[model samples]
Target: MDFNFIGTIWSLLPPVVAIALALKTKEVYSSLFIGIVLGAILFCLSMGTGFDGFLSHLLNDTVGEGDDAKSYGLIHCLSDPWNVGILVFLVVLGSIVSLMNKAGGSAAFGRWAAKHIKSKIGAQVATIILGILIFIDDYFNCLTVGSVMRPITVRYGVTKEKLAYLIDSTAAPVCIISPISSWAAAVSGFVSGGENGLALFCQAIPFNFYAFFTIIFMLMIVVTGFDFKAMSKYDERLKEWYERNGWQLDEVSDTKLQIVEHGVGAKADSKKPKETKGAVADLVVPIIMLIVFCMTGMVYSGGYFDATSANYHDFVDSFAASNASVGLVIGSLTALILTIMMFVVKKTLKFDDAMSCLIKGFEAMVPAVLILTLAWTLKSMTDSLGAAEYVSGVVASSAAGLQMLLPAIVFIVAACLAFATGTSWGTFGILIPICIAVFPVAAPLRIISISACMAGAVCGDHISPISDTTIMASAGAECKHVHHVSSQLPYALTVAGVSFLTFVVAGLTQGMGLMASAAISWISGIILLIVALTILKRIKCKKE
Candidate 1:
């Protein structure tokens, strides 16, 4: 009965099935569940086990006491400390957002922004600036930027899909490039072979084409008002829907927008935001406090406060050692408590109303939480099926013979694996070690290849429907998850194509050393992006 399918071509079936079904049906929850089930079934077949084995793989009680005896099931995924921490952070963050909305902090900020930012472009620029500034963590960036900028973007007729796209593009791209961010930590921790992981990560930053180019492309689209066909079609539909309803484009409120975003439901009505005494500080202060507390929590988690710890008192080292999930949970909870206290003390919200946000916040995030749980379970299923091992083995086997074209190859492979797995750090773990093993520690090509791994992982994570960051972006914008994925695909793919070409140039020119290869690669990337954008603009013009 043994199928011998684990770590083979068949290992990819579950994710491929899930992704295809989700994209086709536009039903994320069911699609992910089916994938998880398929993975468990496959595992059972491979191991020559029966229904009992399938059930164990599906939702087991086995404790992962050691690496050899590790269990990957829906229950185990949910029970993992890191997973629990993330879920806790999401609930706290959702509550904080609810409290802000009920206290009128969001409304106040929107009104304030309305006077200062008079155009759609201005609003988008502000959003980009805010996103760039919050580079400590992508999850925090996604939710915080969406909560703060949603009102202004809505006022300016920014479609919820577009808002989600903006939130998503900025979240991981900015995080991947920031030295003090969680992504840097993840990448640094993945390196081996007698090299300084952090130092190598810093070296790889310049060659992370997708991260930089995605930012560049976002700015271009924002500045030029150019939209690809998919996004443009959505824009037209939004305009027509607004016009049919006899609402002025600029006057559309966030509440009515939500109705258009996800159908007419009582959920939209109940979540209709109310403005308290309009004070910008009501929004600004809470956000500032969140950032401060979160940063402090990250450092503390890294043992910055412990005298006996190696990372003690060193900001960068502490950040590199920080546990993002734990830090985010701690920071978000403290911020939530303070925000509720501030609102109640100021009479902006009654204590009872403030307490009510607990349920409201959890309610708001239920959809995201459900999607995330399913996604996590699906990932667990893939793990049980040896998806990572399969991908790593493939990369390791093929990499030695593909030196000059290796960076581009790595980028594409990493992108595909990450896209299927819906986890960038997992992709990093699989590809980075292979890259390290293929080239000498100080080889310039090694650095470029490593950068490609980081870039491709972020790129795939950026566009993947099941990625938590993507889900967070959808939640943050309060957009339909499917809509966000569809609208952002063309845009993300455009950048990915350009990034792929840039990695090719880097690989071809590695003989010139890191600086020369990087310079050539960046210059070529910019030219290619400009050419691509120009072509897209012309197509838009012709369509118009």
Candidate 2:
């Protein structure tokens, strides 16, 4: 836990090990635990002791002692309020989704959307729009978008890998650019003093090339119906599977069956109730409630309701100060209760059936929740290793002569750190403070540089197989985790390449006005992305 003396190259070993193993072995849990153990060993070695000291660090520090001590490991991480809240929300949302599936809400919406969306393009485009609207949090966006759209997409013959990519692309990228987002809250918290953090964040949105260009790239792919690199091969395989196995969803499921409603001509049993009340409005109303309640909860948590609090009218300030984990839990719980009542009152589900959904939903989310818990604990280990301090020291020491290229350099380093650690929040926490310190308070380049940090963090997390958002995206899409990662890598990298170049342009144009510079850089980046993707499309065409 005491990281002062151990902030060395050894500090980065855990995440590096975890990432490398995930790549080589295609497993996440054991790799993460190994990294945690390695970090604990590093803690011991830094104490200038042997195996006995290593055991103590692993047992007492990583796993924790009795109760009173300020422990800094897995036990401490799980007990933390933020982690607990998000875990609870995941379970609750899972139950709600299960209920929707059971009540025939999902199937009914699928039937409804089937009438309107006639092509693959419509399916993909609609998924993107839905992803953009759910801008509160990436986890919610990933799962909800996947669950709600999965039926429609399958109906239209969209591949699970492609669906996963769409879900992943929209979740983080949309949140990074949206002002009223948890990503915004995390970014603004990095800025010190009485600075209008939200204002600066909004200003940087235009310069967030990775986030914006990822969206552009995604839309172009969906519109054009193209795939290249590893994605191309996977896309072909999926087509073959659909052709050979028919339109059943089982080929994509990993042992566990997807939750589907009781229906169809020959498949429907006489005992099943009619799905009269479960219309598209059933899905629409609950999602609307969740979004509204989430916003209300966030503001309330930020003391917007406190008459004594100054800046209560300033919604941006309240949003910047709100506790996202607590707010999301509150919002999700309210939405769940409302949804249950609505279902029961409409006679879509009996009280006993709705109650059973609680357990079913928890079962569905166990994998995601387990992975998130591990990811959070992994973050705790990285913090205990002082990954932030080490990154900060390096950035501070190197800032003097590289002013023009510093933003690009910071972007790359942040990307690598996030890719290794699989966490954008942790990466931004480590890098954003360093950017703020290196440049003047009011400097346009300072804001540009910070934006680069966030954009790059999102970009890396987008590609990382171990990233929690990526994991959730895979789960939501009901795709193989490895398949999702492989298919999404090329798309993420293409955007990241354009984003890095944009940072270079932004750095060069720092003397220019912020808005003008952002405009120029964004235009250039979008052009580059389109060009690069077109080339890939051409290659795929030639191969075909």
For each candidate in turn, the TM-score is: 0.95, 0.91
Candidate 1 lDDT over residue span 1-544, tens digit each? 3487788888889989998999899999899999989998888888888898889889973534677687788888889999999999999988988888787788778877888988889988999899999998888999999999987887777877888999998999999988888888788778766666778888989999999999999999999999877787777776776677777866667677556545422244757654457478878888898899998888888888898855575778778778888888889889989988888788888999989999999999999999999998899888878888988888787887888889999999999988999999999998998888888876888899999999999999998999999999999988889989988999999999999999989999999998999999999999999999999888778877
Query: Highest TM-score, which number?
Result: 1
How far in Å is the alpha carbon of 44 misplaced in model 2?
1.7
After superposition, the stretches of candidate 1 with alpha carbons farther than 4 Å from their true spots are: 61-67, 251-275, 309-313
After superposition on all CA atoms, what RMSD does each candidate show versus the true structure? Answer: 2.5, 4.4
Q: What does candidate 2's lDDT look like per residue over 1-544, in tens digits? A: 3543367767778888877787678787787788878877777666666787666555446433568344666766678898888888889888889888888788788777867887878989999999999998998899999989988876666778889999999999999999998889888887777787788889888888889888888898888877766776765665575555445533322111132221111232335344456777778888888888888788777777876767464576778888888889889999999999999998988999999999999998887777776766666676667776787688778888889888888888888878867889888878887887788887988888888899889988998766889989988987877778877887888888888998999899888888878888878888888789888878777877
